[model samples]
Target: MVHHTMATSTTRASKASSKINPMNLRLLRFLSTALIVGTLVACSTTPLPPASPPPASSTPPAVGAVPGDTAPLPPPLAQAKSRWVPVRWAELPGFSTDALHEAWNAWVKGCERPAPAFAPLCGEVRRLSIASPEEQRAWMVSRMQPYRIESLDGNAEGLLTGYYEPLMDAARVPGNGFNVPLYRTPAGLGERKPWYTRQQIDTLPEAQAALQGRAIAWLRDPVDALVLHIQGSGRLRVTEPDGSQRLVRVAFAGTNDHPYQSVGRWLLDQGLVRDATWPGIKAWIAANPQRVNELLWSNPRYVFFREEPLDGLDAAFGPRGAQGVALTPGRSIAVDRQSIPYGTPVWLASAGPTAQLGRLVMAQDTGSAIVGAVRADYFTGWGPEAGDVAGRLKQGLRLWALWPRQP
Candidate 1:
């Protein structure tokens, strides 16, 4: 009952089986050729035709086959990789004895804080001694004027703070006096506070004569350049190690929510007042014109300025107003801060390499707009000049923040 039948070429349908299906084979060969041509096209690297000139154009990113690839891009701000070698003063084109001392002064001050094991090659500033008491007192008065000099040593939007006597290079050589306007804030405007009065200042004959003599010596010497500082309170741009860019926003000095620095406090530093009554002291200086030197001795902090913008401090961070955030230097190690809370220490190694690559620092500040997983704000230090510098610094940063417990 099981029968098997096998068809052969010569069987009943042999004629049909022997017929060649040339069309089917030809179709298969055509498809194979098509696939090979497509692969070759994918590997091709022919140049594109040039476009006609447009009316206006900015440089475009590199164009190729791939999409979403921003690599191989040139640095838009500074160079791809900037080389910052340690430059000896004598080796520089115009290094001088005075410059050396100034740099040294900066070095000394920086060393006073928690500095690296090895220090920058800068020097400390030396104060000039005034021989005559009258000259010293006069010099001190002019020195206290709030904003009266140009800073060749700092960037714009920066603040200035510290100790040094610089010439108020306006009109005549500073004698024993000078004055500047202190506008009433949140209360009135165009109101000027006359800091040094003539008669009351003359009461301290010993201190006055001493101050005058010290000033004269300073005037004789030619070390009267102003220091420009960058106060942290705004956008900052810095370069990265891998030829990339980063933007770091920094913050203000002082503990947050503190009152503005008063000139009377400076007076206390100079030993001008036994007890501080800023209004009374100012009134007394006004009443005593000839005694201005004693009044000058009471003044605190040196004055600095550039010829643009209202005091950047008031505009950026007066009361609720904010020029930028507040921070401790080198505290933010990474760019992202949500994980790294304010007051955490960080080392910015990936963005900017340093002498201490993995050094620990404190994070004493925060920024309003400092969002994302990789962003940071560096807090530059005190005064108006520093704020100017802080405003201008922007970069794409790769940083690392240190935990307080870790550091």
Candidate 2:
């Protein structure tokens, strides 16, 4: 079987020994907002451009048939990379260069990768001297649309973003799915918001009626709680009141009723909020409805839901007793609980904008797809940004486990 490799071009302001893989935190925020707000249609999701006037069915010179003598097949994505790419909003194509430097720079901007090579963009800029604003604008327009075409009508944004998760994994039990819920205009302005709970919805009477028997359900509030999935039987290593460490096997996935506005300080790396420190940020999000989406979308991590300790909350959201603080979390990942051993130290290589925030950070939690495989989803912290960023990314990876080296 033949394999294909893509050559990317990128410029380097600072050279580093290791490459970084991060996703766009801002985009993820929009994605989270997308669910609660509305489906955002980019050209990638736009209806296929009107088909090119049917090409004369013809044969190529290489084939036995003479040119213009046979049938014509649709060109490959690379061949037609420009035409099919969306030009709406942020999804535009970028300029191309035959020169190696420009080619190199483009690769860097496209994905999160370790760095050791010279700046591709520097070379492109210097060599072709095509770094002019006009050239740059044309180049950016060429960035392949991120995802398949989506609806842009505000009403459609929520619908499309809403379906991203269910489309990928059905067993995806919901928990205010987006870490930060969308706080849009008072209800009835647009589509109803989606919601979820920590435990199975079947347990709650309201959930049953809300779901109406669907494996999954949407929330009207958007800012519902999220329940992390627990797996396997590893004991949490926590020290007890007696000053001794204890082992408490944990659920691969756990449940919680945390809110999007609740975990700010920590998610954004700000300090704790003491007292009824004003509904400050959350209130602002609620009141600003006109373009709340744009404002929130600017900062990706702004929409993350936070775990305890950092946010002054507890394991469950308040003071979690000795269990929460001393929680010697069975080394595991949040996404795939059972698959990735709780205590194993794994290296995560993400391919998005978020990874740029925390480069090569440790992976303490576990998720389903996060098992032994070469894949990872950074806890994008928690909340809407976390949810949005987490859902949008899918990339190939390299994994390493921290263990005693073979003698």
Candidate 3:
């Protein structure tokens, strides 16, 4: 999602625009605060699996070491560039200490549309509902085996980045201060593999004609809109034509088919900014307002979105991910579908520049950039605080997929 200053509007056009009223500004602050604290933490129950046999020996395993348990191991599933090596649950860092109850929500969501291998386990998973963290941990130990994921070249370490659902102010119709358009997918999008480039979408008559009357919302900043495109989904504080305001979500519908090109990389290549973060990009844009469009057009990829209602419980959850489950704020991850199947429970351990994270996360989503066996995009949830964490979260990472033990 796009990142920008949450302060009052300072642009001359925005100041002159009637849309930037006190009510709107108040709503923006309220939304920002809501986004930060909207993440719900609740306790629920699921069914537990039948008990398994005790370990071969009564002795506890060494810390960070996998014990030689006599549990049966399943044959490894082949992937394009990764292999899974079976390991005991004791090998997972912080596995016993993590708040598994927190992650249970995401796991239960995954069960709604489970992977083929995981389908049979879903009923038991639900039975474990309302289980304590320790109970959940013990149940997992009895029912699942942790598989260390390694790349083809034998590397267990890989990169981890973060992403979130951004929140922005928008208008249902073009007027007042909102002028930039966020479009739905154009007709005949399937006709072209790589659709019109960003520059062409803004300049070509045919492209413009195709998108006419398709604007889902209008924003004050085109750069913010670009961020929404990159993030693939966002929450909009939309002012309707009837002057009513409501919170709604615009999820990824389709892309232009062109490969994603990072505008931050463009800035780095141009040597205009050493730090290509969202703040840095915004600073660059502030200083070079005349060339903001040039910076945006540098990337060819364009994304489209579909509007979703944000009412009742829907407001508390995020868009459904690749696993077809509504993503849990701190427990959902996007991985290489080839390396780790959607709906799998994963143990993530990372220590790097941004933060240290060791937790149980579900592989519920995927991204274009999230390639390779060890690569993943950690979903940080919605709001600016989440965005801040996501923007700075490139780190050294290791992962273990926890799958059911074979009989």
Candidate 4:
């Protein structure tokens, strides 16, 4: 069945990494609010000119930091894909009411690989983890500037979608009803640019031969296999041959190099269904079971995976995003790097069918479909409830980049 999420059709293979730097409590106090107000006034005198479009390359920008010097901070520069217009703290909706301490967790996680602009603030960010929402808000107002993100044409509204890591059951070896396989990257995957299509992998003897003995786990549902492939990562409860059960994560290892084609979109275009969400697609499949293969083969793209053990601490976080940090359930977002760089803190707001969101989120990941200024993919975390939200969320969005202020 076709699931709907920005990650469903757009996620690329990425390994997971997690780190949180140690804390030091002796950092200086907050900058004066009056000084920050004055600086904002000066910076807001004129809107920055539009920046050149972001590079087309898939490689992410290098991690960097400002020099550890006593000099005043430099003026903020425009992003490769969006312009920044400085705004007052009052411009952010629901800013005062948000439980900023919740966002602080994500902030500290991001500090594990602080961006050049945010590097200097990591110590203070760490120290404030246990601070009150009032203190966090005060520090944010005193130390950072909020810039309303806009496209080259000055549009502030864009799309908001949601994604989550799926959770499912698996067998260490194919059994009773667990016949579908999740294989590791097959040998010589690099030899062919666009590897065997989904249909080929399912039917071609040579393709199956290459993947033999490569199955890390077997799942019960082919639809579930598609779900795992679409989401790019998942948690599997595997029952081993020895009758031991363990939890594990299967992260994105590689793909068949085929371009992702959304089966939901295909179904919509074919007029085979009115609602193209996962449930609707499944309904159609259940009614016309004979056409299951036809629906599955609509998009040829296939993803491969690598299994990672899920330890005690690992269970608390989602898979590592593009920023190389484990995503905080409600506080991490996948954004187009052209508009918002990875590791930047973003103020996100949206209200629609699936959710009403107004809070701070770290720009920790990016998806191919999550393009354009003011766009975002909210990480709803893992499991069934998160999956329900991800499959249904598609709404309007507005963004403000919370950038570092000059000391």
Q: What TM-score, computed on C-alpha atoms, does each candidate reach?
A: 0.21, 0.25, 0.83, 0.81
Give the winner by TM-score: 1 or 4: 4
Q: Which of the two candidates, 2 or 3, achieves a greater lDDT against the reference?
A: 3
lDDT of 4 by residue, 25-61 (tens): 1101112332454321100111111223333321112
What's model 4's overall lDDT? Answer: 0.73
RMSD of each: 35.0, 21.8, 11.2, 13.1
**What ordering of candidates by TM-score runs from best to worst?**
3, 4, 2, 1
Q: In model 3, where do residues sit more than 4 Å from their true spots?
A: 1-77
Cα lDDT, all candidates: 0.24, 0.24, 0.73, 0.73
lDDT of 1 by residue, 303-394 (tens): 21212121222222111112122122222211223434433223332111111121223333333333344433443332333322233233
Tell me the lDDT of model 4 at 371: 83
Highest lDDT: which candidate? 3
- Candidate 1 Cα misplacement greater than 4 A, ranges: 1-337, 352-358, 382-392, 404-407
Q: Evaluate model 3: give its TM-score.
A: 0.83
What is residue 154's positional error in candidate 3, in angstroms?
1.4
Q: How far is candidate 1 from the true structure (C-alpha RMSD, Å)?
A: 35.0
Across 133-179, the per-residue lDDT of candidate 3 in tens digits comes to 56677678888888889997777888777777878889999989899
Q: Look at candidate 2 and tell me the lDDT of residue 236.
A: 25
